[model samples]
Target: MQRPPRPSAPRRRMPSPGTGLTPLLLAALAFAITALLTLGAYNSARHVAQANLQNTFEYRSRDAHLALVRRMAVYEEVLRGVQGYLRGSVNISRKEFADYFSVLRLDESFPGIEALGIASIIPPGQLERHEQAVRREGYASYTVHPPGPRPVYTSVTHIEPFNGRNLRAFGFDMFSEPVRRAAMEAARDTGQAAVTGKVVLVQESGWDNKPGVLMYLPVYRAGLPAQTVEQRRAAIFGWVYSPFRMNDLMRGLLGEHSGEVELRIYDGAQPGAEDLLYLSPGTAPGRRPMFQRTDVIEMRGRPWTVVFSSTPALEAQRDTVRPLVIGLTGIGVGFLLGVVVWLLASERGRALKLAEKMTLELRQSYIRIEAEQRRMRVILQNAYDAFVASDAKGRITDWNIKATQLFGWTEREALGRPISDLLVPPDQRERHVRGFRRFANCGSGPVMSAPTEVTAQRNDGSLVQVEVAVAALPTPDGYGASAFVRDITPRKEAEERERQRQQRLDETREALQRAQKLEAVGKLTGGVAHDFNNLLHIISANVQLVLRSPNKQQQRLQSILDAVERGSKLSAQLLAFARRQPLHPQVVDTARLIERMDSLLHRAAGEGVELRHTVQPGLWNTLVDPNQLENVLLNLVINARDAIEGRGSITIALSNADLDGDALPDPEMAPGQYVLATVSDTGRGMAPEVMERAFEPFFTTKPEGKGTGLGLSMAHGFVKQSGGHIQLASEVGRGTTVSIYLPRCLREIAEGVMTPGR
Candidate 1:
């Protein structure tokens, strides 16, 4: 019975599932990831915004600096113009200076310029006359006195009558004032612009008590030494000085943005001193300086400082960004939590098992989606074409990096703006919108293919040409459109340049063709003229012998002789035209040659046309066939006269010119000095077709009876044979210019006397 009781019962214990740590671990991880992401995003956004702000400030600062420099350049230009007028040997007077000053006043850019005046170290006698003029004008307040070894007088201040006030301190010695003295001495030493530190003027009887800085630019005579102490070169024309009120200069420089920013301009040489240019009201009057002593010398020599501080409004703007970031972060966390909770609660056991098996796959899918989105964004940003997408209503939905670069606008600034606003000029906006709409519906238009040339408007209101391509994308509710725009101005310009180059090449080829044809004609004409000359000589001898015979009739013989003499003259003309006649070559001074030929050339040109000679005085002597050259001149004049069709001008210019290897028509030609003779005519120019055959024999524009058409052919042959080259340039409705270059004679010719013929 006791053993049976011992085995009575083994108490049954309930099985228990372990407390869930997996869910807790997942929640904790989610929190950690959310916190890390928020912090990283906050830092990245802050850095980007800060960088944008700094870039804007730097751009504005540079603009202000350049504006000041440009203003100074303008002043220098005005002064240079005045100096030019003075150097023209014209008398410099008060009236002339006043007129120049009036011009300066009329310039809107120089708004705050106070005065512009000229001063000079006066000679002893001129000083008295200046003083007398001032006294006679009833300007008792004006005073003049001698200064240094050379007496100098300051003119009566021009501001006196305008301000209705008289200041009698005109005789004040400018050399005694330390600021003015330093500026003057620097000008004398450097022969450049010299500036002085701020100083208060004791002679400011009419002007308010405002300290100013002085600038001086030196003026020296053309031949005088720039810097010297000797009496002969001691004439230091008093400095052309201008005084700028420190406060006014600083205020004007600040412009419309004065309240939005703080500025400080410091003299780097003197640090921790009261020479501050400007300080905003926000800055304490006596607070510790933001800049250290070392910072002052950083910009020494050309010492300047520009301190920029953001306004309270900008600070508030920065402060507002923080709450927005926090709000966005909270929204993100809630969305993530909702997604996880939904997955956990709806299908606890089944989802957990499936998630465990497919975790890696799901993660890979998410990573791929993210990478694709990033790739798309990068492609849009870096593409050279300006990509823009718009909604159905023509409101901009997206803009790419190239759009920003081309239009000077950022994505943030351009988004949600009207697509037509940027792409259409004011005059064509309606038409452009209609065209865009048509393309959207039809899927084809002028700009639908590869990018075609069009103009786009920039943020700064500048127009630039672009090649544009467009596509319409179908959407569930409406249509979206994208445009690809590429800048094509440079390409268009290059194409135009190529077209012009081709045109010039064509013109040159035609000219060469004409010249070749002329050479062939000249050769033919020369042969014919040589034969004709021999025949004419034989006939002349026979006629002379018949005239001396006893059986000859006197009247008949006279008539025959006359006819023979006329025939002889005609033969001579033919020889000249063919360039086959004997020539006497000589070293002729071109200047004298032109002067001597002026009358004859004018006579040949006739009364309707003007013949002018612009022969340079020192024209180099050229060795050429003078008789042939003269014939060449005559032929050119005749051609020019015919081209004129009655009334025009013919200009003959003779000058010395250098022809280098690079300038030669071909490698066979040598480089050296040459005497250039140019014959230019303002006439009814020949067309391209006519010019192409102008030099050919028997290709004359004249009537058959008027000309043999051997003029230019002969001219070209003669010039080439005399060791020279000729070029012809012409344009329809413009004129023609023929240039001949004869090699300069560098050596003296041996003199030879001509003996009597046997």
Candidate 2:
């Protein structure tokens, strides 16, 4: 069912493009912010790189300064070594001084040192004595050099390896120079080692001159008090010193080539070019330096200003591309973010429009659903069959009046009650519950396979059979069921009556057919008996006539006995086949019958044949004519005896048997529990052709007049009429077995065996 369409709502206009914070404006803002942040990052990275470069430069410069200081200290130690040598002997000769200086091995042990010399502190009056004292050692020209007068003259008295450039400093007065004098004075006052400022050595004369420095250590008299400056000055014997070229000394510390940073050392506190004692090779001309720093280090008593700067190689090592990468990334991210925001806003507008359209459709759908529900309610209340609805948990949710009337319960009472508990039989409750559970858990189809029959209980505790058509009703919560139920008990009863009627008809037809078969057998045996009657009549007439003669009386009487026996057997076969023979059925134990007949059975089997009677214990009793059964057994024994001819064994076995219609050897026989009696012979067995006609009257495998062939025929007919079966099985070499199955009697056995009339 459907309802009328809902009224349409007025459409609202959408905002035009370039509305507040358009994509372009937003993009511009994003870019500006990102650019600002990127610039800040770039500045931060630059400052960090600068600081790092300066720190690296300072570390390298300080290392270089330490190397220089350490080298100077080693040279100072060399002078102290010389001073110690003199301390052992106060009056050392010039030859002794020369020997000691040569032993110092200045050239090999202390590389980069130009020379080692001893400076004697000569007073103004003792200058000539100092010179004469040094000239007497071998230098004829030895005299206090820089001959101008001074407050105190310190003269280089002894210079080792006094040849070559070192010969120039053999009598040089170091105290005459201000820088040299200052170092010597400091050594004397402090009684420690000292170094002079950058100076031109007196030995420098060639064009390849390098700036040089001197290290001095004061020597004092052995017993003088040298603790104070005055005492040190008064006790001063001389000074021991070594000179070093700045170029060679720096080379020993920094290697032959410049490194990542450039090094510049100034002799004094001022880093002025005039005072620059050493300058490393400048950086590549085109690439300017990036970082520079100045540091001061004490050179013994003086301070040297050391300047360090980044070279081209050092600048090349810095990471300068990070800032560019960050800037580019920021620009790309800003653009993408703006595009994303634009698309999101556009989609938001489209979503709003779509939602409005959907709202209209939804309202219309709700109206249609309400109309459909009204229609459903009308159909449900007035439905022909009982209608019931249940939830997923098998509890009733809806019940129409028809359902209430059918179940004898009102809707109010049925609602909220489990469907099984409300209407289902106790025996069927679990099964219905399982079906409903399958519906709920697996979302299966109908709970009862649709249009199924179920036995149900009414509200008054009465049972009713109902035909139920079930269907699954799917709701948002889960699965529920809708069912139409109708009473089927009357229909089921009529069907049962029809079935019983049909069964009765079938049984009657079968009985009629069995009667017909018996009639056919009776007809055949009667005709044959008629013909045999004529033959027996002739034989009887001849016997009666022969009885007149006394000579052949015994032969005629024997002939009469044979003829009468043949007639009696034939009549018996005809009576049994026609089902006209009288039968006295009683509960008889087969085992007991076999026991009573044992002697008789052996006698009938004759002396040449061995007769065996075997019976199982607990065998079931059978209802049959015991005399007829005894006759049947006797006939089987006689036949076995005849088949054996001279010597053989015959076995009669009795056992319990159970059979169904299919298992019965005779298809016409009924199925039930039975007592089986089997007679087996170890003799010439009948061939298939003979066995087929073995139950036919006047049919025989014996020589002429040997057998009437009515033995098995009578047994088969009588067994059939007594509601039992007869079976014959034989093989050419394995002999034959005839099994007779009699219906088992369900009542008590008779007390005594009856034969004949009884």
Candidate 3:
């Protein structure tokens, strides 16, 4: 500690010369720079707000146009259906036409189409007869209006619902008006639906005369070819047309009012009263909108101009800004600048002490920065992934220890080598070189600041999958790039395996649903078959007894007996499909059984099919009913014979298979050894839809009265009841295969073996 000095007396000093003017001058300079910055910020904010408001207006315009076009398309479909009926029918009757329209319920279901009507194209001479023909259909006073002699006359002959609104247009001549005639002629010549321009419809009364349009679809004669304009006119029979009011259609589509935007629609390019079809409430002559845009939409070969404008309420909501924030920010910044200027000029001695303190602080900052660099070096050396640094030319400048371990290259060997040549695959080396040049020239690349998946080559010439992220480092000359790479081979393989497992699960679920449905149908069929079989048994016994008592062969009695025998056979087939037939099961070798049936199978297959059997030695034995097994084989063999059109081969293969818990052939089969029996035919196979229902009883592709559709169904039921699974695969025009997997038996072949025919 040191001793304290004596206090000195305070001295008063006068202001220096010109010091008062200096403060005023400094304050004026600060205000000028602050004002310039504040004005620039305000202008930029206003411009940005205006651009955002313009985009909002344009988006709304497109949405309104799409809504109008989509609604008009729905109305076109209604006209096409009516046109099709007229062309298809030979003669149109009054009752038939009325019944068709009554089912449509046009007024209740479709609000836009006011009424549907038919207009006849009549000659001047036959006009009287047409009127009489209409009167006979209960319309007494019908006549073609605009009565005059012309080359052709189109008069409304029939209109549906027979109401006051539709009756008003019963005799109006559509050919007299130019606007309606243009649409009709287009429909006849082009064979398509056409819409007319703006006009007051004939259906309107005194105050309801709104702007409306008509849609016409032409109907040609039944047997004529209307390929040209001249031929189409000669073959024209009539027209199916409908009328629509603009106000009613717009109301149903966009409601009574659009809250945020005003709309105007015009018939064509011009925007005058004659061409203007519609205008919203606030879009009248004198109202000026804040933001507006125009779009043109095409409907049925006619262009409609649509203009969308933002209302005052919408503009105010979108463009509003906070004035208080701007004012406060400007004031705060000005005050801070004034304080800084005053401190600099008035406290020169204090400034000197501050400079000395700043020098000492700078020295401490250098020590802290050096310590941070050391920490970063430690992080790079101990990181799990490789971190490499390269120059603008892609020469490796720095390599971490992880890089050496990953690529099997020493740091000494990796330094000063081109990055592409050292790590990138040979096929991708040229592409990497081109990308590096572009990055150096433009200071940007697609791979910068993002992770990318790529293949990299190691020193041993093996490729590895890696995920790389690159960052640009600012250098004294230009810029350098640094990359961090991580191996991702294991992750990719895991993702692929998971995808395969999910696919198998989906297939299993679909198969299970089909099996459940078929099982329910089989149960129902079995109950019905059991009851019918009892009735047939009683009938056959009585018929035989009656014939014996008569002691004569009556033809009718013989027919009755034959019918009973057929019914019993059908019942047995149903029982087989349901797996309810009586069975005595025993272990048997599939190879020996097939050898016994070799000759019979050839006879059943016919000369067109070449049958062959390939049986594996030491095949596992399966426990099944011998009689049922023989029946199943006969059904399968006959089915294959029918499938072949001319000449083909049918092969039977027998083998042994094993099923695991994770890899099961079918969801219903247990994990164990199985005996597989497959019957394959090279013939015109079934389509996908046919193959899906191939196992259902009474479902078949064969013609009626030629064969019963219970062959495959019976085989499916028998195999499932015998603790086995069945699978079928077929492609049209290629072939068909039916595979049966039965549970294997471990018992020795020592019991009595049943012959194939028995």
Candidate 4:
């Protein structure tokens, strides 16, 4: 039995080559390699596309910025020419000044200038000959009109002094007007040119319609000799004053589309703060100022405010390109990867067949790989994003298409260069490298899967947002890592925009809800007021009838009549609060209205508060019921006093505004003009929540007896009924500004004709 067992030992196991488990292992390895290569190729292509797009954007932005700067420089040159004549750096006779202005008008670019004039500060005696010449030549007419309450020096131009247009202005004296005097003082004090705030200036002596702002530049004796700083400057002999129409000036600087941009010029000479020299053609939308200041550095002591603007055009352009690049890169990489895998598989079985077939298959695979590589290179060359690869020791092994595109480096230039030297943000490099090492050791267990957003340095020394996904690769000797990065700047911006939109929606919803609630309260108050009026009338009538009776009953009836009369007055007030009574709207001067109600408002505000009225001179008249206006004033003062809780100040101001089509906040308004009545209070201000509900009927913050809450609601309804708008602005601690804008009358006053009664 033991001898027979020896025969079984001779049966040996056959070795299987390239079959079963071995083939399975080889296939799995090939799949893994193919997957890694495909991913790498795709990422490389993506990097290339992103980099190219970003470069194009940067180049375009720079070009636009430079163009704007050059345009502004041209504007400065034109301004300097005017400045030269004003400062007497260039001697310009009246004829010469007029000629210069005419030439400037011909250019058509400086449309902001309404008219140009030279006013001599030296008294009539000093410049009598010049004035006589002006009159004799018919360039300007000087008339000593009948002496009235105020001395009016009227200068009329038969022919436009500068451009020969028939423009005339009357009743203006160089020495008069506070704003003009201040401008002259500034010119002398600073020994340079000066500009004034929004002012009304006469354009053409006899013409009463044309008005504009004045820019005055002083003229000094050019050859004056001196030793000290003061001695070198000549005395203020005269000034070159230009009538720059506020709207026209803005239009000229911003072109015809001034509505798209906001322009503000700030004068630094004003002591308290910057004075607004100019506001563009239209006021800013959304009730908020768009741009703060666009300053012109003083060229020889003349500070000019050039153009300050907030435009959405540039920002929108910057945000549209990043995603496009990413998409293109992804498509290219996927296509190339499929080709590479197909070629590798096609070559696999041919290695042991015919030698020619093996060689041919190898060549085909090489050709396919090269083509894919070339495609990847082309994509990277065009991309705007930065792409980099590092070896196990953190040395830069590969810098693909996007890396060169974004960082301004080529593969030849960046290969073998330490990635830390160019790609790492200075402050984040150390931390990033540490994290990278951890990821490399752990196969992305800790930080690799985390979608980290970080800033990477570009070739131009700018930082860009990069969304990175990192993974580690293990080889025979060591480990390395690859980062898949996508430029996320546009995405971040999109998210921010969406957030703001949502916020605005929420705010709008809240405002609408508050408005609806207020409307409901108004209906209730109106019903109560109507019923109360009927009751008051009945009681009064019955009391009157009883008073007609004889004896002791008559005396009692008289007492009842007195009580009924008081009750009737109270009902009238309640009706007014409910805005249910008919209003007789007529042209009423807001200044006069405020003056008439001052005493009542003061009394209503009590001893702890001070009531002040700032009525603008030459205030525009508004069409509204005089009684209702007074009631509005009273209600506002009373509310303001209550808001203060004890002591504070209340100010009422009246002003005029030109509301153009682009200036309206609501789309329902028609363009033209308006008059503004403003009431401001220095009190514990209302929060956004409170202010939103302040106009709601019956929504009171005070105890039941203290407020009717219908006051503001009634005011809002009355204003709306009168074809006007009411806006309220308040902060938690910064008090409140309530403005009422009423349409302005289109009536024009005839020259030299007084009103029937005046």
Candidate 5:
């Protein structure tokens, strides 16, 4: 069967973008997605840029705080050096201090400090002496000022670099001011560096009256322990102090980089107008900055809050190029990606329409294909013949269930086997192979293109006749073959039976004529033998009488006796073949009987032949003359020995047998249980003509006196009369086998003797 061709789908054109709602929806979706992505990018860029700017501001603020701390520490270090200088000596001179101050180069090395000086801690009792000492070292007018009565006085005694500002600081009572006094007292008590908070230095000019601070380090008397507060206070001699203007200090600390950030220093943690210490020059007055950072630094045991702020100009200096470029690029890419998606969606819409049309066509094609398949299946399943297909090489490629039923082989078992080898009988396989090759070469053969009767093999190895028709299957590459076979075994068997019946009829007519002749001869021979036996008795008595009378013919008379005895044996054989001999029948175990004759059979086989016997277990006893059965075995073996011209083997086997009516070994034999004795020889076998007449009387293949040939005939008669069968099979090169099947006895007969055909 051929498959129906599939139908193709019709193409449908996509609608224009302006005409459809789909394009508008896709455009809107693209716009929405792009807008969201652009906004997200911008926000991310802004956050990152702001964070970098904030970090820049914080770093600058920290730098400003560290600058302030380091400047303050420098001034304290100068003070401590002066304190050490003062405390190392009992008396001091103006030139001696000037030399020390000149070595410092305070104007270049340490800026922001206005002057460095010493304040002596004088008691009210020694105030006059301290004033006299200071006046001796400098101007004659110098005296401790702000002369209120107190228990102790800290008076500035020595100052440098001896400028106009240094003159003003000289002889000033620093302990009289609260800010300066607090710092000095702290220094005296703690024996550490201290600084005054938001002080107006006495040395500041009226035009430059900015807030200032003072640092003090106490110098105690030599050889005094200042480990405790009380000891430090008790041992305090004078103070080494520096005066500073906050504005100048910050300017000196920040140097050229001071404009990078706006800075303000407060005297304490809280910023106020009175406590404001310094502000950078670039800061706008009274204006807040864009970014601010604050740090509290510890100076001389006090907390100074330094505030650093980033102005607009400072923020502009921070990096902003990367975010700007990223934001623009993100918007551009988002728009391009959206456009691509829109175009793809448009194309997908056209493809979807085409696919829908194709689907409908495919659905129709599938329906047609399914219907065709169902029709083919019905024909293959219901047909009585077997349908088989094979490739050009004769390999079976397809087989239906009917093929399985006919060949006794399953589809799985048959496929892929060479068809000729699988189905053709051994004798016919070569011809089948030749036919296959002819068909392959020419696409035609005697068997192909026509129905023919052939013998085929079944899985069980039985041969069956079949009517087969083979046809070439046209293929693109070449040609294959398909066969339709119907089993004709039953009809062939009927024809065969008819042929055999006709042959049997002809043979039976001939056998009846031969029997009539043999029966007449047997009657004549019996009459003569009976008269001869009477004469032999008379002759034997007369011979004995003659011998006793000493006659001259005695030797001749003995030879006559020998000849008579041989004649008698020959007459007995003739009678046996004619079916007229009396037999002693008994229920006997044939296996035991054969076993008893083993030695005799071996001896009869002669020296050149090997004789063997096999008796099956549980053999049934047969109703036959035991003596006759022995004779039959001896005769068969002797004949087998003569057939072997050289070394050969004789095998005698006894077994029980049951044959059905259809499968009986001999047509003349009744179907029943029988015990079979088979004697076979590996020797020169007989031709078909000799095998056919092997049981005829006196039909010998040997030289004149070597064989009677009546041995098989006599055995045949005895078995037939005993209700059994005797059959022989031989192949020219293979060997010869004779089988004697005797009917099993159900019970022993009381008759001691019985005549055949009686």
Candidate 6:
């Protein structure tokens, strides 16, 4: 709104004599300070990177050591199982022992076991007799190996699978050698497992030689005193032992463990070339490790020294200059700022009005930028999902509020930590590294910017299910990454619960349909059986009458009468299955009913099946035929006995359950208080398809001639006719449980009744 100044010849102001060099001096000072700052920042960054490298090396070393300990412990436990098997019997034959060992499937269970064998201590006198006994068993070429005998010779009498390289160890005299003899003696004297020192295994072929060790678990004569050292040595029968090759052993123990950490194992407590059992492949000779640590792990009383060292690959990562890149970026920005200040200071001779206007504009711009930054921080802090950004080296650069809450690591703790170490699970870190490497090298990676469900780690060492959307960020130096992560654990849990509920719902519906089908079959069978019974009655009467009147045909008529009688009996069984048998219904107490059957039920279950009863006091009463109920219980116990193999237990548990309107156990059952009598067996369970048709007539899982297949069908008919619902539940290896829910007697009584399901 102000009038423009009149145009005039611009005055060429002369530079002041005192201020002439001030701009140059200020510019030089600014640059010098900036250079010093940049140098300090770079040095600090390098120091921090070195510190991180040391920490990473230590972590990997500890991990490798722990892994070795765990793998060895598992092998020791397996040896214990073998030792237990030997002590369980006194006369274990060669075939029996071989079959037992074959079940172990050593390669699949634990990859490095060279052989599991039994070494028998051969007194000098019994050598010929032992050879004769082994020869009779089929190893014609078997003989004591190494062709020498000590005071007490021990030969591997049984080693399996009797094929492959394991065959080479057969008849190998272990007690003749000092290393093997020492471990065997340790096991016998201490009555505990022991491991031998480093040795070339007898199982090694001529083409290969790997450091090997043997684990020995002593076996003593059954029913002998082996508690003390002298007693154990005297009664010791032999030892169950296994051999291991260190190269294959370590490979199995430490799968895909990165080469950043070099592993070396020594057989004894000290690390020496003579005692070196294993040296990890790819270790650069003469390349001194940047980080090294030594620890000893005791293996079955034998100390194993493990050495872990950092290699050049680890050093390369530490020398990446990522921290220097970050520091320089920051310092360069400050340096440029200093140069701008120098330039502004140099323009002091300009118009005061214009200078004031430019200063105001800069102040406004700075305020606006600061306000925008604050706004951004507030938005990030309040975002719903966790937000994290990392540099190309996978170092966390920025973290937001949601990330802090989700990961349990505060912003300060997570800022410079590797993203994989902080968030990626231990098992998945390799994949994370590969993805980042691919993006950095090829500028492309796995489906970036698309949400993917993955497992993530928390600071507390627990895991979380997260859906993360990652985007690659191209920077001046390399590729970086930003991710939005949402915790999906709650949603996954909800889905699981819903899935289970739906499964249960489907099962109940299927059971209801099966029950309806059985009911229809029962009605049809009952009508047909009734007509057949009437026709048989008439035929029997006519045949008997004819037999009385005839002489020559009397034998044939008598045979016809016998045939009719058998048919009539079969019809009676059919009527029973149909629940059409005549019965006198009476009020029965559920608990008292089981109490009266104690002797009868036990006799039916036999000694193998431990019969048990759990009768709930004050059980509800139901109206059912007393005799029919007794028959049902006896049949159930007998059926349960047949269902079980060897020793098992059958429990008849009685409890009162309420089937309310909200969630009736079955659609066939009305809302009411019911008496539940559950007959559960620790026996072979039924498959789902078998359980569905279990109530059908002539459906049996038993051998063809063993059962009539009418037991469950008749029982089902009896329960349904008595106004009850039956439910069957089973798992393939676990067991089976059958429950019968009978409506309580409407009339009031002091005691109650129960239904059966087995």
All models, RMSD in angstroms: 26.3, 55.8, 31.2, 35.9, 58.1, 29.0
- TM per model? 0.37, 0.38, 0.40, 0.31, 0.41, 0.42
Q: Could you give candidate 5's per-residue lDDT for residues 1-758 as a string of tens digits? A: 99898888988998886677776777777666666765665566567557756765665576567656756755664564465445323258778888877766677656687888888777757777767766666579977888678766767777888778778877788888887889888977876688888888888788968888888877766555555778777777787888888777776454444666887789898887778888777678877677987788878977788888887677776546644554455455445565445434643673475457446644654554465445444445544578788888888987888888998899889989998778978887887777777677666555432255778898999988887655565455456776767888888789899999989999999999899778756755664566467667767776777778766467657756776776777677767776777888877766657666777877899989999888888777677777877888899999999888799999999888988765687677778898888999998899999997788776679996698567998888887877777889999977899998888877743466422220
- The number of clashing residue pairs in each candidate reads 0, 0, 0, 24, 0, 6
lDDT tens digits, residue span 61-166, model 2 = 6556655666666565456446545641235666877776665555654568887777876766777666776667676887777778778777777777777888
Q: After superposition, how far is residue 432 of candidate 1 from its true place, in Å?
A: 56
lDDT of 1 by residue, 1-758 (tens): 45555555878975555447666777677767767665665565566556544544544455455545545544454443343334312235556556555544422444434445454544555655655665677766545533544433434233211221123234444555666676667655654456665565433554576555555555554334332334213645555655555555555554554554455555445533566644555654544432211223221013555455555443333433643454365346556555345424633654465456346544554564465445455556655467788876677887888788888889998899887786677777898788767655644454432234667788888889876545455455456677667788888899999999999999999998898768866865674565456556656665776768757656556766665775665555456545575667777766766666777888889999999888777667888767667778888998888889768999999988886654675465579888889999998877888877666544577885677666776777677767788778899888899999899998554466221111
Candidate 2 lDDT score at position 550: 76
Native-structure RMSD, model 2: 55.8
lDDT of 4 by residue, 1-758 (tens): 45554444566878776556886687677666656665665565445444433443333333323333433333333443354434333334556666555655423544455555555543343234545655676646564222333432322222125434324342135545677767766765554446665465555455443334565655444334322336423444555555665555544332222344455555454322245655544454555422233345442333545444544432232323433433343344335455655434533433244346435644654564475455444433443334456776677766766666556778887777767777888888888678666655644433332335778888888998876544354545456655545678889899999999999999999998898768776766675676467656766776666667555666656666766775665555556545666787767766766666667777888898888878667877677776777777778888888888666888888888887554686687777678888889988888888887787655678886787566887788778777888899998777888898888765544356322211
In order, candidate lDDTs are 0.60, 0.74, 0.74, 0.58, 0.73, 0.75
Clashing pairs in 6: 590-752, 590-753, 620-752, 620-753, 621-752, 621-753
lDDT of 6 by residue, 523-578 (tens): 55774576566666767776766767776476656666676776665555566777
Superposed model 1: Cα runs more than 4 Å off: 1-19, 88-91, 124-130, 145-172, 201-208, 221-233, 277-314, 317-320, 327-332, 336-758
Model 4 residue runs over 4 Å out of place are 1-580, 606-608, 660-671, 732-734, 748-758
Per-residue lDDT for 112-155 in model 3, tens only? 77788888787657777778877887779888888777777878
lDDT of 2 at 220: 72
TM-score for predicted model 4 compared with the true structure: 0.31
Ranking by TM-score: 6, 5, 3, 2, 1, 4
10 residues in a row with least lDDT, candidate 6: 342-351
Span of 10 residues, lowest total lDDT, candidate 2: 442-451
Cα lDDT for residue 245, candidate 4:
58
What C-alpha lDDT, on a 0 to 100 scale, does residue 577 get in candidate 3?
A: 74
Q: Record all residue pairs in model 5 with backbone atoms less than 3 Å apart, i.e. clashing.
A: none
- After TM-score superposition, what is the CA distance of residue 634 in candidate 6 from its true location, in Å? 77
Q: Give the worst 10-residue stretch by lDDT in candidate 4.
A: 151-160
Off by over 4 Å in 5: 1-28, 87-90, 318-758
